[model samples]
Structures are given as C-alpha cells and as structure tokens.
Target: MTTTDSTTTSTGSPATAELRVDRLETVLTPTERPVPAGPWTASLVFAWRAILKIKHVPMQLFDVTMFPIMFTVLFTYLFGGAIAGSPREYIQDLLPGILVMTVAMITPYTGMGLNQDIQKGIFDRFRSMPIWGPAALVGALLGDALRYSLAAMITVALGIAIGFRPGGGAVGVLLAVGLLLVFSFSLSWIWTAVGLRMQTPESVMQVSMMILFPLTFASNVFVDPATMPGWVQAFVDVNPITHLTTAARSLAHGIPDTGAIAAVLVASVVLVAVFAPVTMRLYRSER
Candidate 1:
C-alpha cells in the first residue's frame, strides 16, 4: 500500500515552522473516454438505461401491462349490465375512461422510482457527473412514454377482443391516445416533485395514491357523475380527470368535442409549467 507522510519543525525563531510531505505515486494507464454528449443525447441515453432496467426487473412492467387488461376486462364484465344494459355497451363508455384512469394511476410510479434512485445514491452520482442536470428526470419520463403506450395498446386490444369497438376509427383512437400520453407526461412532474419532497419511496406512493384515487374514481370514469349527489356532481364537473375522460370518450367515439380536447391540453400545459420547475428545483437542492 502507498501512503503519505508529513513532518513539522520549529526553527530557533519560535514562530517559524516548516512542514514537508512525501507523496505516494502510482502509474495510471491512459484510456480513451467518450466525450460528453449534448443534453438531448444524454437524456436519450438515460432513457435507454431506464428501458434496459426492465430487462433486469421484469416485474416493473406488471402495473402498466396487467392493470390495464384487468381493469378493462373486470370492470366491463362486472358492471356492464347494471350500468349500460350490456357489456358491449358499457365497454364503449368504460374503455375510454379506463384508459385515462389507468395512465393517471401509473404516474405516481415515476415519483416512486425517482425517490428510490435518490435513496440509492444513484441520483447523487448522476449529479456529480458531467451531464445535464435535468437529463435523468427527462429521460425517465420519456422512457415512461413507452410504458404508457404499451398499457394503452393492451387496454384497447383487450377491449376489442371482448367486444369493444372504437367508433373513432384509427385516427380518432390515435388522437385520444396521444392526448392521454401528453396528460400523463405532464402529470408525472407532480409525482416527481412529490418524490423529491418526500423522505421515502413509500411516502411518495402513499401521497400520490391519496391524491389520485379520488381524482380518478370521483370523475366520470366508471359511472355517470351526474347521478351522484349535488355536491359530488359539482366536484366531478370541475375535475380535470373528468375533462380528460370526456375528451378521450368523445374522440374515441368519433364525437369530436373540441372543448374537451382544448381543456385537457390547457390543463396539461399548466401542470407542466407549474410542477416541472418545482421538481427541477427540488432535484437540484438534493445535491
């Protein structure tokens, strides 16, 4: 083992002291290193890393994949008769709402993942590296787009398999899916901020669920909100989830409600605008 040694001495002048150190030396081999990529490139690299993590931890996908299928199938069969006279009729109404709810439900995982990385010191390592500060978060969000897409596809496929046909055709369905993705991406910033603020991943999950459950269930997802009590109906009318579900339902059914689409888009933009800065600030504070 190499070690360093130091010594101190005082001269006759009492105030004068001299210190010397012996430095241990070791030979370092020269190695080629990749240049730092641009912010977008770095973000994409991190995004790829997020995707690759799934290969090692396949269960991470259970929520995105299985939840959609189960929610669609189970709800369609269980309440179809009571709600809409038949499963087929109920699916048309339910699938769109379910799609929105499913993606919304999954957004909290983004925060949970961030909290885990923070706790594991992975985020600290990233902060110390020569990379864009926001790249890690941005990349994770982008990677989550794939998860959202898969969930949406699985839900739609199962719906079709079990007798739900989207009247919106290819274009309408595509539009609805696109809108949902945008909403989910924007909403995730809230969770990311929560993750940064929370002390633990479990706390982040708990807080996110507390907010999401009412937002999803109280809206027009499973039943007609108008049928609820007057006060509850008032809340459902203004709920952002209700607007998103309405927009999705309209587009999926080929009804083309521009108002609902516009509302959802505006809400998404507002969410990103408000939460993104907060999340980034909290992220930097951690360093």
Candidate 2:
C-alpha cells in the first residue's frame, strides 16, 4: 500500500481543524472497458446461459420430455377403452386434451426455478449487475417456452405413433401447437409471480401444483363435461383449460372453434398483462 502523511491545519478562528493527506490514491485500475450490452442482447445472453444449464444437466428436462410421454401413453392405454371404447378411437380426442394438460402441468416449474434462484442468492447477484433489470426473468421465461415446445412435440409424436390422426392434418396440428405455446407462455407468469412471493421453492411448487391439478383435471380434458354433474359442468364451462382443449381438438379436426380459440387468446393476454407486472414488481422489491 502507498503511504501518506496526515497534517492538521487550524482555521483563523481556531475552532475548526481539517485533516489533509499529502497524497491520495485510489484502487481503480487503468483499463479500457467495452460498452455494456443492450437490453435484448443481455436477455439473449441470459437465455443462452439457461440453455447451457440444460445441456449440462439433461435430466432437468424430465418434466417436459418423459412425464408428458408417460401421461399420454398411460391415459391412452389404461382408460381409453373405458372412456371411448377403444384405444385408437379414444386417442383421437385424447391427444389434443393431453397436450394441453402436459403443458399446463409443466409451466409451474418457472416459479419453482425462480424461488430456487432467490434461495441460492443468484437473484440478488443478477439484480446487482448493470444489465437490464428484467433480462434474467425474461430469459428464463424464454428458455421455459422451449421446454414447453419440446413437451408438446413429444406428446404429439407419441400420440401419432399410437394411432392419432388429426383430421385437420399437419396444418391443424401446427395451429393447435401454436395456440398452446401462447397459453403456456402466459400461464408461466402466474407461477413466476408466486415464486417471488413465496419463502421457499417447495412452497412455490406446492401452490402451483394445487392450482394446476384442479384446472387440468376438472376441465374437459378427458370425459365430456355433459357427463359431469350439472354443477361441475358449470365450472368446466368457464374453465380456460377447457376452452384451450376444445379449441385444440377443433383445430386438430380441421374445423376451428373460433369462440374457444378467442377465449383462450383473451385469457392468455389477460394473464400476461396481470401476472407479468406483478412478477416484475415482486422481482424489483425482492430482498
């Protein structure tokens, strides 16, 4: 360390004295630094980071890959005959419903992951950086969208292998998937908000699952709502998941259900509008 001598000086009134250092030095290094990244560039970098984590720990994908496949197969084989009289016949309706279910179930992981980041103090570290504030969260959401896409594709492929033939053909399948992705993307925001408000990752997981289970199970994903009790039918009638599943099925059959699709789209937009702001506010105020 450089040494300095301190001298004391008295003002003319002799009431106030100041201490002065002969030489002052600072710790800053003399180095040229590159310009900071733009918001989009910064977000993309964080997104790439999320992707790399998956590459290293491929098992993290089990929810999106294995679980979706498992659900599609198990439901088709075990309950197909009981529900629709034959596995092949049942799969036609079941595939579209199951795709919605799979994505709905998995979207909550976004919140749990956020809670984990906070627990590990990674969230604080990201917050202290000079980059755009929401980049980390935005990047994480984008990465999760990719996982949702993977689950959707795997579910569709497995359905096809087992006897699913969408009357709407490839175009209908693609349309359904596109609609599903938007819904999933919006749904993840709810979990993201919950994650920030919760004390632990487990709390986030538990709460998210609680909300999702009823939404997916109580909806018209399996049997027709008409088969359900009239009271239950009332709930199913307004369930967003029911709308999504019906729209998916309609699109898959080549006859689009404009009302259901519009409902799901409106729900998606509302979810993002409400939960996205809440998530961001929580993110900013998080300790």
Candidate 3:
C-alpha cells in the first residue's frame, strides 16, 4: 500500500491543507487549410457571401415591392393631371424616370451594408480568412447590384400592369435596364466609400438617403425639366440621374436620346473613376 502525503501550512495559528495543481496548455489543429484563390475567383466568393447574407435578411424585398406601388400611385393619380395634363399621360411620361430613380436609389445598400460589416468587425473575420484581396468588398458590391436589377425589373413589371407600356421593343427595354444597372453600380462605389469610412451603419443610411433623395427627386423623375425653374433646370441638366432618366425615357418611348446615352456613359465613367479608388483605399485603410 502506498500513502500520499499533503503539505500543511500554518497561518495565524491555523493549519491549512494545500493541494498541488498544474496548468495544462492546449493546441488545436484545423482539419483543413485555406486554399489559394485567384483574383476573380476571390471576388466571386465574396459576392456569394453577400448574396447568402441577403437571404437571411429579407426586409430588403419590402423596398422592391413598395417603391413601384408608391411611385405608380402617387405620380399617376395624385400629381399626374397637374404635371402631364392627364393621369394616364403622366404615367407614360414618368414611368421611365421612376424606373431610373428606383435603380439608382436602391442599389447603394450594397456598398453601405458591406461598409457596416467592416465597421462592425464582421469584415475582420473575412480579412483573417484566406479570401482574395478586394474579393470580399468588391464582390459584395457586385452581388448587391443583382438585387437592384431584380428590383428594377419587378418595378417595371408593376408599371406595365398599371398601364405603363414601353414603345421600345424587347431590345430597347433590355438596353434601358442595362444602363440603369451600370449607373447604379457606379453610384454604389461612392456609398461604399462612405460606408467604409463611417463609424456607424445608421450614419451610412442617413447620409446616403440625404444624398440620394435630392438627386433622384430633383431630376426629371416626377416632373418635366421644362417645367422646372431655370436654376433648378441647370442643376438637373448636370445631374447624372437626369441623363439616366432621359436615356430610360428615350429607350422606353423608342426615341433617340444619343446625348442622354453619352451623358450616362460619361457620368458612369467619371463616378467609377472617382469612387473606385476611394473605396479601395478605404477598404485597405480599414485594416
């Protein structure tokens, strides 16, 4: 038989028994290592992550359904007669502008949401992962653009149901949709920059809405530019959304708006040139 002895210590006339202890260290090995990703592949991976996130959070769909109904009802019935001399004519005149407005306003969530993730530390996890550089952020932006496309199409469909018909054939309609997306994507880059730099998501929302509303409404969206006062018309003429709305209207009405298309192209190129580097820099600086 073996006996184990415990050491006792005396403190202030009281004897206390002490148990010996040892500290243990643990090491965990991952089952798999991250694989190297090509640039485009990494972008796609990040884009897919954003899409999956959208699936879990579905409040975004409300905007898709609501905007079309709201605008269609408001402009068609409320101010239609005052603006276009008839409600039906107003619907015809304003549908293209509304389509352009919807696309431009709704798509910024892509960049804004991504920026929120970064500000909230979710992006830190992605940064630590083996995802490709620029993939997580840029891919997320592009993925959100898909939502904008869907929303635009649905809104256009609703317009059709409400007596809005495009004089342009399928190809013209397709071109209009394509141009909306292109411009929206470009605009999103600016929001992406803002979101990346901002400390809170709410700030992003407020700032973005402040900028978007004036841009969308002050243009030829609900009213004709000819009816606008001179100062307002000057502003609208330079506004990128004006070009987009004009281009959409031209395509829908089967009219040639070569100047509007050129304006859209120029504005998109300028926005991309301005915001892309800024967003990327903000992304890297966030590290």
lDDT of 2 by residue, 1-287 (tens): 22242233222423433333332233354568777787898888877887888899989998679888898899999999999999999999999999999989988887888899999998888899888887887788888788888889999999999999999999999999999999998999999999999999899989999999999999989988888888899989989999999999999999999999999999999999999999989989947
Candidate 3 positional error at 118, Å? 1.7
RMSD of each: 10.9, 11.8, 10.7
Residue-level lDDT tens digits of model 3 in 12-59: 223223322332222343457667787798888878887887798877
Q: Per-residue lDDT of 1-287 in model 1, one digit per residue for the tens? A: 22232222222433433332232222334557788888999999988988998878989898788899889989999999999999999999999999999999998878998999999998888889989888998999998888898889988888889998888987888899999999999999999999989989999999999999999999999999868999999999888999999999999889989999999999999999999999989988844
Worst 10 residues of 2 by lDDT: 1-10
Worst 10 residues of 1 by lDDT: 1-10
lDDT of 2: 0.89
Backbone clashes per model, in order? Answer: 0, 0, 0
Candidate 2 Cα errors over 4 Å, as ranges: 1-30
lDDT of each: 0.90, 0.89, 0.79
Summed over model 1, clashes come to 0
Please report the TM-score between candidate 2 and the true structure.
Answer: 0.87
